[model samples]
Target: MIPKYRQQFNQDFSQEKYSLLKEYLKQKSGLEPAFRVSESPIFLKKEFESKLIDASESIIDQIKTLSPDLLRKAVPDNCYVPGHTDKPHFLTIDFGICRSENGEIEPQLIELQAFPSLYAFQKVFEDTFCEVYPFLSEIRNKMPHEEFKNYMKDLILGNEDPENVILLEIYPEKQKTAIDFVLTEKLLGIKTVCLTKLKKEGKKLFYENEGKLTEIKRIYNRVIFDELDRILDLKTEFDFREDVDVKWVTHPNWFFKISKFLLPLLQHQFVPKSYFLHEFPENENLENFVLKPLFSFAGSGVNLNPTKEITDVIKDKENYILQRKVNYEPVFEDINGDFSKGEIRLLYIWRENDEPPILLENLARMTKADMVNVDFNKKDAIWIGSSNAFFAE
Candidate 1:
């Protein structure tokens, strides 16, 4: 997000560079990126970068303590079931932050997802960024110690047969993020099959490959329970919660274990103050907060600048949360000579038998608007949704 790098990179930006980027992506992965790749790379100060890692570690520790309880409540038959339980195991947490009034870049806990995110395409994006813009000296922000693809494979197939494992999703071809599933299939050598494509008999899940039915031993779950609930005619023989035949890559319980609803309860300094909209303390002013749906993904249903009426009409009050907004520091300088706001999604994978969560991938989002969502900044002059290239410290 530094201005100097943008000036240096954009001075050489041209139509030829864009063409080269497209060709590089097509040659490297046989796919074109869905989003724009910036001419410049994002740079993070050492102090701020360290804080980001500290924040992640702190949140993880809090999750470790409440994981058991949260997992127990995630079950359908449990006394404290939040909602549906058809999909389990995959989870992602997005931290939104900005420069505070005091000049410190602090993180505000943003959206936490219980479903699969753009895992595969993000890695591809990183590789493409490095390939197309190798001349940029500031390209190194945080180079991953391990490739995310290998890390994901290790996490999902630990002590298991890769042939028997399937990445589960619902009508994956219909999903907008189907590209990621395709990449996952290529990298891990695991098949990506729809839930409907799965055949079940006597408590086991199986899918046909080349006219042969292969038994499923483990699931790299990408299905969202909310999406599954919308389909009326879909039928399955096994229950996701009660079934014991398949193990999970990311256990279903962690979705609830590390969510925005639980962010305020955490003792981490990186997480801003948050509370359920219904139970928000009267003493705290609502003006400093943003309203968000408890289970929405990709910045959906988030009211960045909520009006009083909007807050008043909130149905299912318990299903909403008001979090103090973090002023996104316009850190990235763009081609148009304007600073762009940015947020870093540091990806981690906690595998079975591993003592700690291993950092896997890093994705950076750049926007010129007040908020980072694609919808809010589509018209911004130099907005580029891209990946960061990390250099060793």
Candidate 2:
């Protein structure tokens, strides 16, 4: 972290500025953020930024060479999607800022996902933060607004007409991450379609767009198989496992292959020792690790302290993991001098021809709780929520 910028931003931060920031965001996106937005943006020194990138690269190299059999087996028999891609189009690797045994500030890998994150909203949020805190503009946007928009257009829309490309989700309007969908549509000229609304005509899929049946050519998938499985009463004419005549911007199978299911398999200095619940060593102390449900989202089934009672109730032991806890260094101090632990997520986009994913942007969450989720945060916390990072030039 860049201490100078952090100190300057903290000194200049005011309640009014924070209010203005929230207002600006609402005005831009036409809706208030469902999740809390932190009062500060992280400032990363060049050296720290490099370390983060290097850590990501090391993990990515291993991911690329992962056994094809392992990847194919990661997808559950019932949840397998048809037309799987050879590689993932998007990747989000999260790392907790922690102090190493040698007293160096380093990033410890927390979790990762091959699914999309708040890519559209994150850049705008960074810009909004800079707009409210004018002095912070010195860091500048890593990729200019127009350039980033063009990149997104190519990635999500491809060569298809924007009307033919849809950001497919389940009840997108009711989703917490609807803001990103809204912005994605605004930027790429695509529409968000609910999974249940998709109509099947042989191998092709169609969705109602502006009262007309529009054939879907490409899909920017945002639906999670786990969440979809929970909707027992839901019915959709189209199925993910069907061989649909549409391009998957990110093939859904990658979600499982490159998720927490692969975390235990990753061997890196930044990655914590993770083991499947069924394979956890009997002699190892369970208190030193956190239990995680492989397929859950937004920290739904994360237990900070794992016990035999909790593990016993779980019928699917293979779907759970015991990950060694990484102590998040309280390096980010809030206004009241209380520090917040930060988890930085590096967002990457892998073009079809690119060997490795391109690191486009970074987002961080500040929290004083045991984890970064809103449920764990105290009611009266500040400078602790959804945030972005600015790296030194």
Candidate 3:
């Protein structure tokens, strides 16, 4: 973190400017985010940025060379989808800023996901932040926002017309992260189609576009298998498991394969020791580890101090992981003099199979609680929530 930039931003910070930012984002994105937006953007030094990039690449290299058997084991039979990409299109790696045993600042691997994140929303967020505070513009991403949008358009849309490419999700409008969906449509000219609304004809899929049955050539899947499985009353015409004509930008199968399940397989200094719940060693103490569901989103079903009693009651031991806890150092100093812990999520997009995913941009979450989720934070916590990271030049 850059102390000078943080101090300057705090000095210029006012209630009116923060309000204007939120209003501007609402007007631009067409929907206000349900989650809290942090008052400040995190500023990272060049050295810290390089360390994050290096650690992420090292972990990804191990995944690239994993045996087929290991990769197949990660996706359960019921959870598997029809098509499989050689590698994930979108990759998000989360690292907790922490202090090492020697009291040196370092990045620790919190988790990694092969699914899409707030890609469209993040670009607008960075722009909105810079608009409110012009001085912060110097630390923006190297690639301009418009160029990045074009890159994403090429990656997601491909050669197909935007009408043929649908951002597929279940009740997307009702989702908490629907702001991303709205912005995705605004940027890519793609429609957000609910899973239940998908119409099937033989091997082909269709969605009603402006009172016309439009053929779906590609699907940008945002449906989580676990969440979809929970909705018992839904009567969907199309199923993800069945063979379909459309291509997946990033296949659903990769979501399970590249989740917390792959944590144990990674051999990196940044990655903490992890093991399947069933494969956990009896000699090791459980208090030092955290229990996490393999595919859950937003820190759901995570136990900070996991005990044997809790691990014993879990029915599907293979679907759980016991990861060693990394102490999240409070590095972001606020105006109140209370330092807040932050988690930096490096978002990457991989268009080619041979080359590793490119680090496009990053989003950070500040928290004074045990976790970064809104449930963990108190009602009145400030300078804590959704934020973007600026690389200090």
Candidate 4:
């Protein structure tokens, strides 16, 4: 972390500025985000930034060197999507601060996702942060706003007409992350169509927009199979497993293949010891372990402390993992002078057959709890949900 910037930011931060930040969010998106926005942005030094970047690259290298079968084994049963692309179009690697043996601060890998993150919203949020903090505007947008927008357009729309490309989600308007969907539609000029709204005929998928039937050529998919599985009677003409004639911006199977299922496969200095719950070694202690189900999102079904009793009730051993509980360092000071733990999520975008994915931009979270979720920080304070990280050169 950049100490100088931290001190300056903390000294300059005031409740009035937080009020302005909220007003900016409302003015830009016309609706408050369903999630919390931290009171301050993180000021990061180049050293820690490089550590995160290196850890992410190492994980990517380790993943790339794995054999095809080894990689395919990560996919859970009955979750494969057809027309798999050469690589994932989007990647997000999360890192949180933890103490090393020598008591020095180190970045530990939290989780990684091949699916897209809040790409469009982060850009706008960063801009608004800079706007609110005038002196800090010189810190630079991690990814240039105009350039990032164009890159998103390239990844989401490619050469196809925006009309033919749809940002597919499951009733996106009602979702908690709907602010991102709204901004995505405005930024990319693509309609956000619900999964049930799609009509499939033969091999073609179509959606009615503004009383006109439009053929879908590409989909910026936001639909998660786990969420889809919850609905028994919700009828949708198009299914994720079907071989529909459309380009998947990011093929759905990558979600399972690159999610928690693959976390144990990754071994790095930053990555904590993780193992399949079924194969958890008897000699290895479970004291520092947290039992996690493979497919849940937003930290659901994660047992903070695991006992034999907890593991006994697990229906499927293979579907669970025992991951070491990381001690998130209280890195940033908040309003009441109480320190807050921070997590940095490095977002990546891979274009076609690129060897290594490019580290495009990043977003940080400020939490005063065990994990970086809204439930963890229920006491209410700054730095709960979405925050920014500015790298000091």
Candidate 5:
């Protein structure tokens, strides 16, 4: 969002540099990034970075207190977590940032899930950053991708056989982000299998591979329980809660444990004031905030400028939230040399043996409107979706 850095980078930009960046990325990573890679990254002020880290730490501490209970409730069956298991213990937390009324960059907690993101592609993206942008050698703005991969391996496999641990997802072929699934397979050497492929005998889960039934020792679960509920006649003998043989990469409870629904409960100076849509008191200035469905994904079912009648008619009040709208600072300068507003999704992963959460990757979204959600963008906008590039500051 620092305008001076943007101007400096644009002033020194050249077609030769851009061509080199593209060639180097394709040669090194074998995949071309869909977004722009700029000469200059976001220059996050030290104070702002520190505040962001502090806020994240505070939230983590809070979560530590309640995580055990939350985890217990998330299981469909009441079962205690086992101590020794060769499965991935994964945790992810998401944050949404905005400029506060005081004109300082502030972060608001969005959601946390015990699921795998585009972990494999992220590692490749980091490698591209190193190859294309040699000037960033001295900068500390990069995520430790190799370290992250090792940590994941250690957490998921432990001392057990890597062949036995599988990253479990639904029929991944039917999923939109199957490219990520393929990447995970290539990086970890773990098979990505559909739930239907799994055959259960008693409490043990097994999948037939190469015409033989192999025991499923550890499960790196990527299936969303909400999505699973929609399957009509899909038969699977395994029970996620009752089966002791399969270990969770991320225990399912954390999805609900740290969600946007809890934003109204967390007291933070940086977080905008929020309330359950049902519990929201009558305010004549209803236009001041946005109404959002608690559990929807990718900016679905959100009313940016909600009216009183719209808020009043919501039947599932508990399933909705009203959050004060914060203006998105126009941070990214586009190809046309015009400024575009955007939001950054800071990706983090917490391993079983790690003392603290590790920042693994970052994905930014650009938009032309006052808000950064996809619905607000114009039809012809080019720089409005998921973007990743070298950021050194």
Candidate 6:
């Protein structure tokens, strides 16, 4: 974060500007976001920007070289989908800003997701950000606007009828990412269908639209894999694990293969030392490590401060990961004069068989609590929610 811009931006920031921006968000999204959008965006210099990219590349290279045996070990038994794609269509790598022993601000790898972030909505978010504050209108990000849109089109609507491609979810309206689903529909002309609503005959899947069943050719799956079982007596016409007649934009198998499961596999200066909870040595200091459920999303089932009792109670060792906690430095100055800790999530996209995904955009989360998450900070104002950054050369 730059001191000059931070001071200038804070001085210039007004309640009316944020008020109009919030209203625009409500208007653009036919629905209110279940989560809060931060008031300001992060401003980054080129030096730190390069560090973030170096960290992402190191992890992605490890993903590319991961052996089949090691990758297979990541699969949750009986949870593997029949059709596994060679590469994930979308992935996100999260990094925490930390101060090195040398007293320099550096990026430390936190977590990664093989799923999409707010891809469609981010453009709208940044656009609205600039629109509200007219002087900041020339802000630019990593990927060009038109190029990114075309890339998404190629990934989501590839060689198939856009009508047949649906964004798959379980009770999509309940998820916080429901806005993304709506934006996906508006941009690609694909509908968001509930998993329970899908009808299957033999191995083919179809969904009723306008009183007729339209065959589904592809699915931009947003359904969290774990949620599939939690639904009580939920009879889906087709099982996700079944050899169904649809192409997965990013197959389910890659989600497990490239998730927190890969954290232990990644060996980098930026990547923290990690171990499977079951295999973690008794001699090693567990006091500094954080216990995380491998598959939980949006910071669920994570224990920031864990005890011996917590680790002993876990029956499924493979499902839990013991990760070293990177102390997120409170570097971003808040408008109220209280500094806040932040986490920067770098979003990447890779086509099938691509060695490494291209860094598409950046997502930042700010918080005043132990963890940079919504649940961690319930009532913190400004610099406390989802945001983006402008990388200046």
Best by TM-score: 3
* Candidate 5: clashing pairs of residues: 88-156, 88-249, 90-249
Estimated TM-score for each candidate: 0.86, 0.97, 0.98, 0.96, 0.81, 0.96
Which tens-of-lDDT digit does each residue in 1-393 have in candidate 1? 344555556776676876786677666555555556554456665666677778777776666666455545433343122233333334455665477667776665565554456677677766666666675534553445255556777767766777798888888778766667777787788898888888888777788887899998878877766567679999775556665677776555545545566755666666788888888888888889989876655666788877768888877787778988777777666666577777777766665555556666666777776767555666545645665635323
Leading candidate by lDDT: 3
Instruction: For model 2, state the Cα shift of residue 237 in Å.
Output: 1.1
Superior by TM-score: candidate 1 or candidate 5: 1
Ranking the candidates on lDDT from highest down gives 3, 2, 4, 6, 1, 5
- List the candidate 4 regions with Cα displacement exceeding 4 Å: none
Identify the superior model by lDDT, candidate 2 or candidate 3.
3
Q: How does model 2 score by TM-score? A: 0.97
Model 2's alpha-carbon lDDT is 0.89
lDDT of 5 at 24: 69
Q: Least accurate stretch of 10 residues (summed lDDT) in model 6?
A: 134-143
Error of 5 at 111 (Å): 4.0
Worst 10 residues of 5 by lDDT: 79-88
lDDT of 3 by residue, 13-99 (tens): 998999999999999987899888998888778878888989999998898899868888889888788878888889999999899
lDDT of 6 by residue, 102-183 (tens): 8888889888988888888777777787787665555466466788787888888898988888999999999898987887
Residue 254's lDDT within candidate 4 is 80
Which lDDT values do the candidates have, in the order given?
0.66, 0.89, 0.89, 0.85, 0.63, 0.83
> Across residues 224-306, which tens digit of lDDT does each residue of candidate 4 receive?
87888887898888778888899998988788777888788888889999999989989998888888889888888888888
Supply every candidate's count of residue pairs whose N, Cα or C atoms clash at under 3 angstroms: 11, 0, 0, 2, 3, 0
